[model samples]
Target: MFGIFIQHHVSKPNPPKKLLCNEGNLLSQIDGKGTVYTRVGGLSCNYDKGTLIISDKSNRVALNIE
Candidate 1:
């Protein structure tokens, strides 16, 4: 599965969360407190190849290939 995961500013000791999907999707408006282990605003993904595209509030895209 492939997808991007973001951790928005939320209320400490935020546990790490992972999302895996066969298709691409977006998650937004997440509320939590500790340093975001991962923070993303947008993502593009292809699960079969384990490829992922992630972006931050600045809209910078990063690719993860596996």
Candidate 2:
């Protein structure tokens, strides 16, 4: 009854509210606060290694650069 009504009204997924750029640069919102960020170098993430590493302009592993 009610389930059938919901099924018929299903809608497409909403578009992502975040934006991303090459080399691991991204802009997103947290707690309804908006933010934007940009990086000067490359970045990488290895799920198996359980790490998300980012680099600075000199390609150094700098997690505290900000």
Candidate 3:
């Protein structure tokens, strides 16, 4: 799956960040953890304590926003 994270700064606008994941099923959770599917594959994601985690079978990515 492909994920896009867009951050908008108060000073200006910037380009969005894109992430790609593979090999997972699409699922959604009410507790801030879920799997999203896109045209490419599936990605598992978690958001907790101002940090966001995105992963697949082969890769894991984390982003922190304040």
Candidate 4:
């Protein structure tokens, strides 16, 4: 349920449902709804006290990348 902003327009409607990361040679994933995704960019996070922090400044759930 997301979309990418490109040329000042979103690529599609109701985007995908999952995201994956292969950073630091480690596997990380975020998923929802009925689809799955893997992308190189999404969130800026940090691991603290056994928890992964995505964003602390906004209440927005989905990411819109161009």
Candidate 5:
């Protein structure tokens, strides 16, 4: 009698890349109710009511959802 054996390997998926909103290309989120937005790499923003404002030292953007 004889038998055969096989081996398999699996790899983990890469994490998502952090995004930034800039001039000529702004990142906007619609219907962002109850959603938490976080900025990676020391980026920060402010949110109030139905508006989201993300700004840096030189640029600023405001997104309002109705």
Candidate 6:
């Protein structure tokens, strides 16, 4: 099963962010629960490895924007 979370803002030109979580069975590799975590943003990235980087040095998993 694959799960993703996207953020939405009112006045922002682009979407808030893209949070992707993938979990499923492997084809023929490991016969166990597989999980992958990744973070992507619409126009800006809160994480440094993605598209954009933010100045806020916080690693909270959730965000509340209104």
Clash count, predicted structure 4: 2
Where model 5 places Cα greater than 4 Å from the true spot, the runs are 1-38
Off by over 4 Å in 1: 1-10, 13-15, 21-23, 27-48, 56-58, 63-65
Clashes of each: 4, 0, 2, 2, 0, 0
Candidate 1 weakest lDDT stretch, 10 residues: 1-10
Best-first order by TM-score: 3, 5, 1, 4, 2, 6
lDDT tens digits by residue: candidate 2, 19-38: 33344553323223456443
lDDT digits (tens) for residues 1-66 of candidate 5: 122222222233334333334432334332335643333433456665766666667787786743
Those runs of model 2 whose alpha carbons end farther than 4 Å from true positions after fitting are 1-23, 26-29, 33-48, 62-66
Across 14-41, the per-residue lDDT of candidate 4 in tens digits comes to 5444433234221234346545445434
Weakest lDDT window of 10 consecutive positions for candidate 2: 39-48
Instruction: Name the lDDT of candidate 3.
Output: 0.49
After superposing candidate 3 on the true structure, give the runs of residues whose Cα lies further than 4 Å from its correct spot.
1-40
Quantify all predictions' global Cα lDDT against the true fold.
Answer: 0.42, 0.41, 0.49, 0.40, 0.46, 0.31
| Order by lDDT, highest first | 3, 5, 1, 2, 4, 6
TM-score of each: 0.28, 0.25, 0.37, 0.27, 0.34, 0.15
Q: Write the per-residue lDDT of candidate 1 for residues 1-66, one digit (tens) a residue.
A: 122223333233443355333345533323356433333335543344455555444564434546
State the lDDT at 42 in candidate 1: 58
RMSD values for the candidates in order, in angstroms, are: 12.8, 12.7, 12.7, 10.4, 11.9, 15.3
Candidate 6 lDDT, tens digit per residue, 4-61? 2233343335432343322321111222356432343322224333423332235433
Residue pairs with colliding backbones in model 1 are 10-32, 10-33, 11-32, 11-33
lDDT score at residue 48, model 4, on the 0-100 scale:
46
TM-score of 2: 0.25
